[model samples]
Target: MTEKDIILTSEGREELEKELSNLINVIRPQVIEELVEARAQGDLSENADYDAARNRQAEVEARIKEIETMLSKAKIIEDSNNLNKEIKVGTTVTFQNLKTKKEMTVKIVGVIEADPFESKISNESPLAKAMLGKSTNDTCEVRELKEPYKILIKDIK
Candidate 1:
C-alpha cells in the first residue's frame, strides 16, 4: 500500500474498527467452519461448496487487510483549530444557492465517509472544494461542475 495518509472522520474510523472486529471474530470463524465442513465431504476435486467457502475466505481476508491498513494510517478530521468557523473537513456549513436562493446544510467529510443521503459531503467535492477556507457570508463559485453554480456561505460550525 502507498504510504499516504488516509483521511477519515472519527465516526468513520469507529465504523471501520467495528467492521474489522466483526470480520476477525465472527466471519472468520464461520468461514473456517465452512471450510472444515466442506473438507469433510470427501473429494477436493469439483467441490462447489469448498470453492465457494475458499472464495468467501479470500474476500474476508482481503477486506480485513484493507481495513487494517486504512485504520493504521487513518487521520481523523479535527475541528479543534477551527475557531473562526472556516469551512473545512469535519465542519458543518449552511449555504444558500445563488440562483435559486435555496438553503441547505452539509457536513464536510473525507471521501471514505462521504454520504450525500446523510448530508455528508467529501472535502474534494466541488461544493466543498469551493467552500473550504471560506468563512460565513462568503460567496464562492464551483466552476468544476458541468453546470457551474455559486453559493453563499450562510453559516459554518
Candidate 2:
C-alpha cells in the first residue's frame, strides 16, 4: 500500500500488537502443523489438503509481513485533553447534519482501526477529513454517502 506513516490510537496500537503476537506465536505454528499433517497424507500432486495448507501458509506470511510493515511505520497519535482547540486526529467530534437534523458522535482514528459501525472513523475518511482542524460552530461537508451531508461541529472532546 501507500508508504505514508500508519497513525494509530493507543487502543488501535494495542490491538495490532496483540494480532502480531498471535500471528507469530499461534498462527505460524498452527499453519506449520497443518502443512506437516498434509504432507503425511500422500503424493503432492493429488494432495488437496497440502495445497490448501500451503496457500493458507502463504496468506498468513503475507499478512504477517503487512502487519510488520505497519508496526515499523506506525506513528501513534498521542492522547490529548485539549478539546477547547480545533478538532484533530484522536479527537471525538460531535456534529449535526443540517439536512436530516441527525446528530452523531465519532472518534477520529487511524485508517487501519476505523470502524464506522463503532463510531470510530478514520482520519483520512471524508467525514473525519472534513472535521479535522474545525472548531465548534464551523461547518463541514461529508461526501462519502450517496448524498453529501452538511455538518456543523457542535462539540469536540
Q: What is the TM-score of each candidate against the true structure?
A: 0.93, 0.90
Question: For model 2, where is the 10-residue window of minimal lDDT?
Answer: 77-86
Question: Which digits, one per residue and each the tens of the lDDT, describe model 2 over residues 1-157?
Answer: 7888999988888898899899989999999999999999989999999999999999999999998899899999888787466898888888999999999999999999999899999898888888888999999898876878789999888
Error of 2 at 90 (Å): 1.1
lDDT of 1 at 26: 100
Instruction: Give the runs in model 2 whose Cα sits over 4 Å from its true position.
Output: 143-148
lDDT of 1 by residue, 1-157 (tens): 6687888988898899999999999999999999999999999898999999999999999999999989999999866667877777899899999999999999999888899999999988988899999999999998773789999999888
Q: Candidate 2, 112: how far from true, in Å?
A: 1.3
lDDT for residue 56 in candidate 2, whole number 0-100: 94
